[model samples]
Target: MSKGRLLDGVSPIEGISPTDSLDTLFLKSGSSTAHSPQSLRAKPWPARPQQLCKGIRGWRWWDSALDVVVVMLPIPFFVLAAAVIFVNGKIVDQEQFTILNHSIKGATTLFPICFAAITGRAAIKFATWKLEQGTTIGVLEQLMGSRTVASALTTQVQLRSFNVIGLLMIFVWSLSPLGAQSILHILYTPVLPTSTASSVAYMNSRQQSYSDPRPSSSFPGQWFNSLAIEMGSMLIAPTEVKISSMDINGNVKIPCQSSLLASGTPDSEGWVQTALMNATSNGSLVWSSLFGIPIELGTKLGNTTFSIESTYIELSCNNKTVESLEPDGQNGPRINFTYVSVAGPYFSAEDPDPLDPWIIGYRGVDITTYNDTDGSAYVFPLFCPDCLSSNFANKTIEAGTIAFQEFEGLDNANATTVFCNPYQRYVESEVSCMKTAATQQCQVTAQRDSVLPHMPPEITYLSFPLVALGLSALLPNVTPIHDATNEVQNYLVYDPLDPLTIMGEDNSVLTSGGSTPKFLSDVALSDIETRLGQILNAFVYGSTWNASIFLLGESIDNLQGHEFGGKNASFVPATRADIVAMIQNQTAAFTVPAVLRTQAQVYVCNFAWLGVFLFSTVVMLIGAITGVVFSRKTIVPDYLGYVSSLAKESPWIRMPDVGVNMDGMDKARLVKEVKVRLGDVSYVYGGYSEIGRLAFARLEETTKVKKGKLYV
Candidate 1:
């Protein structure tokens, strides 16, 4: 072969010599001088491969350390996300929550890109290592360059490949997407409803001082007005409020009071025992009412507990028959009704005639009363004059029936009359309250052994009679004495002196007189008992309301002469401080602590997905470390897949034999001054003219292939 031509049968260029300067070759080939080989050699390479290597052992410690750092960069970001979830458990702040979520998404997205760089380099280095070990060209091609999952899969199937190292390289590449998805699921922020601690305010009636006492006659107008308003509320309040006020299980709730006495019957155990009534019986009285003051003004969402004192009524009744004044009345017509009176053994001696009686005569249409064929009258009386003094003294009062028959000829035969005794008591109770936007509810339970001590005699004497007399005056029916000056029309217009007159005789007068007359016979026994219980409830509840008003230090000047005093005229009103001291001493009031609930967004981690992410990260690190370990065997710089590296070693081109093992970088340093082109480098002439061959070669040695030229 000639000096300028290495391949056999290849034609030499007409004007080029093996010793010609590269500039001359480029000028003859009409190539630009801007890209001349000398210019290419002038540019400096950043780091020499020899300098990067630690003697013959390949890369230095710092180089490997840098690689480790790049691979571990994702660890800190993952740890930060984990730490946020671990510490806060929930993120309530909107800005911080959004920032954390976005940061996590960005980190997961970048994970693939970062992992690809490390693993791609590892793949190339691994291929080079295999090549040095004399692997087949097919395996070398599969591992030589940056590869996608599709390309890796195609190569795996095309070679029917079982090469473990090639499969491992493919697995390492697959981790890019896997690790990204795993990390994406590791940290997340979602909006959810959560209960957080917060404070709120509510009206605590139990905390109010209640020991204050005012003269029975003080602030009569205000007292009467308060009493009237409270009574109206008790009668007309919403059914739900009324129902929530009482605990049927014998429990007590704050802000609400129940008149259903405790389970036992009146006995000698204590005053509380003496106050017990059979609430479960058919004729028992049970009344419940909500306090006029609400527990909380506005809606607050949470649950809390508190303590309070509840005043309620308890009554026990027995059947009895009154004796007739006339002997022939046993065969006369009958009348049935309910009545209230103050004529009992405990009546004050100073005021023998205290007040008018309350009478409710049946209009003869209710189930509570029934008539027998024989002449007879039945009257159910709910009265207890000594109940106040007896409860104050912790004694059971069993005053026999008071005889006062309105009819003359009718005997009290087979009568359903009842002699009922009623008393009031205080109980210490715990309350649980729940509030929402739409509703508020409370649950109360009477504390064990929580019956309170009786009010002081002066206090009870001054307050109880006033309550009784006030109730009598405020009630619906009050029959005045015939000799009185004020002529009040009674619903039953029949003469009280005529015993033969039957009830409902004047129906038009009773029904059409602009009054809704109620008949005991029209009401169920249970309902009648309920109404009676409510009346008793008013007596005690009114006293509490009066006490509350007194404790608040309101002026009571109007009540000076209206007192219900007799022998108890020596009683003095209590001061506000006295009430406060009494309440504190008795521990009758309690302060409750409450918290509010709210909704917020929280940071949550899926530990299962976190495990997968950690596992993938670990696998990636192992692969990168493996690549670094194998790189020690690489004798030349990393240039295995570069087109420039392949160009220098081809036998078809005329180039100097520098060395067979030189990497692309080393070979480029030696041949950068050479100019190259793609064209026809070989051709022959024959009887039928041989076709031209095309390849990359020196510009002076090869001619550009014409577009229409027939060459193979």
Candidate 2:
């Protein structure tokens, strides 16, 4: 054999002796005088042994490569996931302020955390090895030799594969529809606009049309006539004359002609007896004729060509002559008389006879152009008056066109002019009056009763004049105007001292004797009367002769000439058919609000997906850099070097074997015998140098010796 090579392919310098300590052999080789084995046995061990790690895997280029693969493998997957997330983020961010947008943003933030947690486990395991400077298989390597342990362990490799596979799977799943949807929401869901509108609808029906059951107002027009004589030479010039006029074929005419002048005097008793016959023959119109004087007394008016002007008279209460009517003549007593005629019930603003049509119109249309998105709904209102006003001259929607199809009317300016303005004003005034009356009545009624009944139309249209308007003359003969006026005065002029007045107590037939229930609270009754009187005063002003004529003419014209003219007529009581026609011709007008209508939607803008993707890519790169910089190589045990040396040195021994202790033997002797037997057996099996070519050769079994055979 060559001097440089040893048996079993080990070099001579690397070889160790099995029979003796290798240190003793080396010392002997160096000594000049050769000492026997007895002298070597007297030497103690060189130094105490120290506990050190052994047979552990060490750092290698291949191990670093594996760790680098672990860190880099998921980077591409993370990049792909980031791209998808960025796209989803762009989609949701563009749709901001919605619930879905918020959800998508949250998901985008959460995905990274989820990935970190899932892969962090493997990272933690790798970190443990570097931090502790040990491996879980270190003890096994020491017992079985590093070569056997290295081939048996595959834990780290499997863990690296697990993390890579998980990252790839998560990345692939993120591209799915569900994953994308979780990142962002997109749908053409229609949403309501940020505004709304409302409109007023007019009452256009009158099913139960008839006279009011309550005491009805005679009429709303003015009547001009006279109580004085018209043909007679002599008559009384009265303070004022109340006239009762009739509408005969739409013309106002008084049935009786009364004059303010009443001339001639009545005769006394002696003249009555002497000149009664002569006076009757002479045909002179006298005041005695109005007093119901007999012909024998010669007190009668001689001329009977015309009837008496007075409707009623009261002469029974006058016992003296001068106490009677002195207005006709001052010479003798004539008659105490009262003239009844129609006075102004007057036009009421509250109960306008001819109400015009007015209203507000509201419309809600889809505003697709809002936010430049798919579509949204918006609402807006258009006041009819405002629309009709000059402020919207250019914006007025033409009637009868497609835009104004819902409205009922011709596009003629004449019709709109007549109805929209004059009639509209009428209707507005009536409505305002109605509202005021309703409020005032409600207040009074509430004070009297707990629950309010439905307002009666009589109260709605009833006009109670504050002053004794010709209305008192219109009352039936059963009730005297003077008596009512006196009683009303009592109720009007408040006296705090009187309990009955304060209590609103009344003995009048209007409340007593089953006529009607009287109000207990005088305050409440007075308030009601005052309010009603004011409302009537307002009503009477609006119900004038000229107004009545105009209203009647307009009604007739609309019903006969225009289509849908009477569609929105008022339910107000009309004494004449012409008046009803006026109310019927009214119509509530409206215009489409320009705000609700919008231009068509057009989505021509793109999302910021590309920008977001680039940003995410940058973030991913930062993450990769951080991961690479922070990463630590796994700390393999030192047993790897020992295994490499062993493989290089020896081929026969694959592992070290330790024997158990034997019982019933000297412990120290057994230990020495075990070492000596192993050494001798190894030498017999194979020599250190391959040149010797020694092998195990046994001829026969050796004889066993007992304790007796040995010397004592």
Per-residue C-alpha lDDT of model 2 across residues 1-712, encoded as one tens digit per residue: 2232333433333344554333343243342233222322332322343332211233345635755664564455345444444443122234443544454466556545433432332333333343345444433222122112122123323333334433433343233223333334222223222221211112211111111112343232221111111101011111111111111111111110011012222234111111223322442212111111000101121111101011111011111111112222544222222211121121111211011111111111111121234322222212112112233323322121000001111111110100010001111100000012122100000001101111211111111221122222221111122322222223223332233442343322222334332221233432323322322222222222222221232232222233332233222223234333332333211111111211222222123543443344344344344434433333322222222223222322211221111111222222232211101112221333332321111111011223333210
Quote model 1's TM-score: 0.53
Ten contiguous residues minimizing lDDT sum, candidate 2: 441-450
Q: Write the per-residue lDDT of candidate 1 for residues 1-712, one digit (tens) a residue.
A: 2222223332443323445455554454445766355533444434332333422454556666866775676576557546665745554567776776687688787877767766766777778778767778877877763366666767777777757856876777787788788766776667665554433222222221111123354434445455445544444333443444433212232321223234533235321221212322232323333232223312456554544444444333343334333232455344333233333222211211112222221111111122234322223311122222224354332222211212212233222233434434345444455666765655543333234444322222112233344333343321223332111122123322222222223221123335443332333333333345444454344444223322222222222344332111111323334333434333222223343344446667787877777777777676667666667666545667765666654433434433444456656776676677776655211111244556676665566787766655
- Write down the lDDT of every candidate, Cα atoms only: 0.43, 0.24
Worst 10 residues of 1 by lDDT: 360-369
- lDDT assessment of candidate 2: 0.24
Error of 2 at 28 (Å): 30
